[model samples]
Target: MTDDRVLPRAVLWDMDGTLLDTEPLWGRAMEEFARGIGAEMTPELRNATMGNSSVDALTKVYEAARVPESGRDFEADEDAMVARVLELFATDLRWRPGALSALDLVAGAEIPMVLVTNTVREVTDVMLETLGRDRFVATVCGDEVAAGKPEPHIYRRAAELVGFCASECLAFEDSPVGAAATHAAGVPAIVIPSAIPVPPKPTYTYRETLEGLTLDDLAAVFAAR
Candidate 1:
């Protein structure tokens, strides 16, 4: 049977909790890093850090821990945090449920994809080993852009790199920060909440999971825009 639904020009994806179940690993590392700095990682701070760049995440940790700015060594703290997260990633990285199948489904349809994440390139590259570098036409990392998620820069750059206008693309996100970025960029997204709950918005299409998603599901989101 011929497919009647129209597909998007390109698909934009979020990393971390959205595609890879790396949020837990990042959290573990953050918690440990916070402890080392004499700070406890609070739930509120952890949620705030979700979908944020390493710099932003670390800053939040410091504030929550009540570490004075005069005592903070941002570069060193960031490096250590990233290093610890990488160690966990090397042994524990895994895909979210049905993420692999969803990826294959999109690839089989020949829809170009761009990975847009607040993850730094160093850590993102390591995760890419499991995600397969060949799947995406372009990968935009936090370090590569002036700002990360919740800022719209990363999403805007990804769409541009993929040769599509933000309006022509459909984004898949799992966090409020990520959703905000996509919305600000004028990209309609299919939001599947992961580590944190994202508020409902008319501009976003919600799904419980990536399982059983079809081109029609994606097309419906794009067509609505």
Candidate 2:
């Protein structure tokens, strides 16, 4: 099928599951956190809170494990987990399937790519540095914005930093919250499911991943009505 949406001047890419295979690492960290707090971490609970901000995710972990939030010293745990995650990335970090190819395609097209993610600035920097994509035109981290995913502020800020109107940018996301935020910002969003399941239609366009896509591939997808 020919996709005829207007071609975007820039593309906003999600980090974490979209570009790197970090969601499982995050899950492991969360599991460790829950165990450290003597809380029960259930798959259902994880599913419910997948794609949430770190703060929200931690809060859910605490609530689900029946742990007391007060005096729980989440910061220390989070710090330790981040350290471990960094270590894991140092060895295990790799681009998701077809990520490099897709990025190359975009780069070859001379389209400015911005990393827009709900990750904290520090972690986001680490991922970008590790992936060697630190040269992105701009990066908008959830912590840098007043509100995170599911709120359009981050997406709007990213577009602004790239000097593009929301309508002129295309957002690539792997989470419902990210897609919602992009949509709310008036940008066209493409969903690539990772750890989180994609919602049914009437919301966003779903792609397997960026695999098998070239600049021409994207152009064709975006040029369709």
Candidate 3:
């Protein structure tokens, strides 16, 4: 079932937990924010919005704790939290296991790669600079788009920027929101579940992580389809 010649024209990567191991830093920042407002930050609440946008994540936290803060106040708190997280991330960020190898593999195959992330440009830039992958062919930040994950706009935009059709691209993701976005864009997705477990369904493909994947591995995966 291997189709060695059917490699994707482009590979779309998710930045946060997929490429960088920064989810714990994010959780710590969110917990600190909850404590600042005298809210009970429980593991349940954190799990609920593990892969959501900052605004949506905070709104869910507030709703679950029954905190009474106006939208503006919440936004301010979220901004502060994100700033703090970015600071910590900038100092301690490291790419996930085999991430660099995966990137090199794609690059060697001459496959253009795009970063499609829910993180803002500032944070993403820091990550890109740190990892020396700032020269990605395209990037679509969640804040720049009208709708973030669970919507196909970001993926569609990334495809457009890279001059590839959605169907000809392969999306790499670690969250359900990212998977849904890729699916909505009519692209096949290779999921690498992080903190959240991927749903058991027939809609998408799964990989433990990018640890041992090579360019040939990806080409084989796509060719089999």
Candidate 4:
């Protein structure tokens, strides 16, 4: 609450678990896809898939299912998973608690924001209907980047697309993978963990939820980095 607190040049948001409760839908689709290949998605395997790119996630599923590489058709499996998740998104999507209020707070401040997600563009576009497309000045999808979360590519690209240096932007993430990516990109982040707990990082300030968050809270976290 210092009068001199400075805001970031822009905000970067993580879409799936961070803003929308789409992780379960993605889990359902992953389970179905695993079963199609005669494998089951155990809780451990499903947890590992969270926040990973489609290629990486599907690979994990196949490996956990004990499906040999020769038996895996990555493209077909990913396409099926995305399609199934899209169906669920159309019917089952919901916002995380306090997500709307948080978005409104940032938007009200007139700061630029970008949606940065490991979700593919196809699924992200559908979810945006619920998140409201106008909230973000630009979106960087997993497929658009050379690599996804835990890799730093997506975060870097998102900041670049919005004309900000990575260090000059503040990121919001809910998963360890996403938080790691933001940290690696050199952006300070407010980590609001969802289904899984995120390990602490020097540049990350953790919050229980977005509820009751103020611009002052964001400024304090951003300034700490």
How do the residues 1-225 of candidate 3 rate in per-residue lDDT, one tens digit apiece? 954377888999898888889888888888887777667778778777676777777787777667766543765776787789888886788787788888888888888899999887767777787656654888889888988887899899999998889989988888888888888897788889888887743446788978888766676656667
Instruction: Give candidate 4 misplaced runs (Cα > 4 Å).
Output: 1-3
> Which residue ranges in model 3 land beyond 4 Å of their true spot?
1-4, 68-74, 201-203
- Colliding pairs, model 4: none
Please, what is the TM-score per model? 0.96, 0.89, 0.91, 0.96
lDDT of each: 0.89, 0.78, 0.81, 0.89
User: lDDT of model 3 at residue 147?
Assistant: 81
Q: Over the stretch 31-73, how does candidate 2's per-residue lDDT look in tens digits?
A: 8878887777688876766667777777887787677767566
lDDT of 1 at 46: 85
Q: After the best TM-score superposition of candidate 3, give how far the Cα of residue 120 lies from its true spot, in angstroms.
A: 1.1
Expressed as tens digits, the lDDT of each residue in 1-225 for candidate 4 is 646878888999998888998888888888888888777788888888899999989989888778888988988877888888888888888889999999999999998989999888888887888899999999999999888989999999988888889988999999889999999999999999989889999989999898898989988976675
Task: Give the range where candidate 3 is weakest over 10 consecutive residues by summed lDDT.
Answer: 69-78
**For residues 1-225, what per-residue lDDT tens digits would candidate 1 score against the true structure?**
996787889999898888899999988998898788788788987898888888888888888778888988988878888888888988888899889999999999999999999998888888888899999999999989888888989999999998888988999999999999999999899999997899887779999999999988998886776
Candidate 1 clashing pairs, residues 3+ apart or interchain: none
Candidate 3 global CA lDDT score: 0.81
Model 1 global lDDT (CA atoms, 0 to 1): 0.89
How many clashes would you count in candidate 1?
A: 0
Residue 173 lDDT (model 3): 87
Which model is ahead, 2 or 3, in terms of TM-score? 3
